[model samples]
Target: MNASMLSYILLSCVLLSVQAHNCQVREIIRNTKSLLNKTEESWSCRETAATPCSCLPIPEPGHELACFVEGTNHMMEHNMTTDNRLFLLNQSFQIQLDRNLCESLTSGKECKYKTKGTVKTFLEKILKTYQEIHKSRV
Candidate 1:
C-alpha cells in the first residue's frame, strides 16, 4: 500500500477508537442515573420508621445525582416525619463513600447533604481520556 493510504487508514482507526470510548462513558453515566433514581424512590419514605430504605450508588460526577435529589429535598421534610437517627445513618453512609472517593483525588461538590462529596474525578478521567484520543478534533 502507498504511505499516504496507510496513514489515512491509521487516522480513521484512531478516530473510531475515540468515539467508542466516549460512548462507553456515556453509557455508564446513564446506568448510574437509573440506579440513582431507584435508590431515591426506595429511600423516600412517608414514615421515618420505615425499614428497607435503599442507599443510592453514588454517581462519579457526584453533584449530578445530588441535583437529582434537590426536588425531593433529600427525602427530608416530606410527607414522612424526619427522624434524627435515620438522618444520621444516611449521613454516615454518604460520608464513608465520600472519604473513599476523596482518597483517589476524585472529589467534587457535596451530595444532597453537605457530607456527600462530588465524584468529579471519575468523570474527569473519562473526559481526559477522550480529550487525549481526540486532541486533533478539539
Candidate 2:
C-alpha cells in the first residue's frame, strides 16, 4: 500500500489501542517525552548481546530501542506504525543492510549507535511536534 494508506491503518490501530486502554494522547505524549529525555542522556550502543531481540528488561541488556519498548508495557509496541520507534526499527532492520554486520545486541555498534542518534533526533522532533500540538490545543 501507499504511505498514506499505511498511515491511515496505523492511526486506526493507535486510536483503538488508546481507547482500549483509556489512555489520552496527551498523557502518552507527555510520558513519551519524559522517557525520551532520560534515554537521550544515557543510551548507548552495545557492542554485544546475549541473543538477538532478547527481552532482558530495562536497563535491558540489548538494543536500547528494544529496552525502551519493554518499558512502555508494550503500548508503544503496537498500533504505532507511525511511531518513530517502530518505523525506525523497521527501517533500520530492513533498509540498513550494512547494520547487520556489526556485533551488537542484534546488529552492530555503529548500527545501534546510529539508531541512537536517530532516536535522539526523533526525540527532539517529537518533543517539538508535541509542543506545537500542545500550543494548538491551548
Top model number, TM-score = 2
What's the CA error at residue 56 for candidate 2, in Å? Answer: 22
Candidate 1: clashing residue pairs, number: 2
Q: Residue 59 error for model 1, in Å?
A: 3.1
Q: For each candidate, what is the lDDT?
A: 0.37, 0.40
Residue 28 error, candidate 2, Å: 3.0
Compose the digit string of candidate 2's lDDT tens values, residues 1-138: 999999999998886565333223254456556646555333332334652221223232335333333423332443322455444433332322233321233332221222332344444543454455456647
> Can you give the TM-score per candidate against the true fold?
0.22, 0.30
What's the count of clashing pairs in each model shown?
Answer: 2, 0
Which parts of model 1 are misplaced by more than 4 Å?
1-58, 61-73, 79-83, 93-106, 110-138
Candidate 2 regions exceeding 4 Å error are 1-25, 40-117
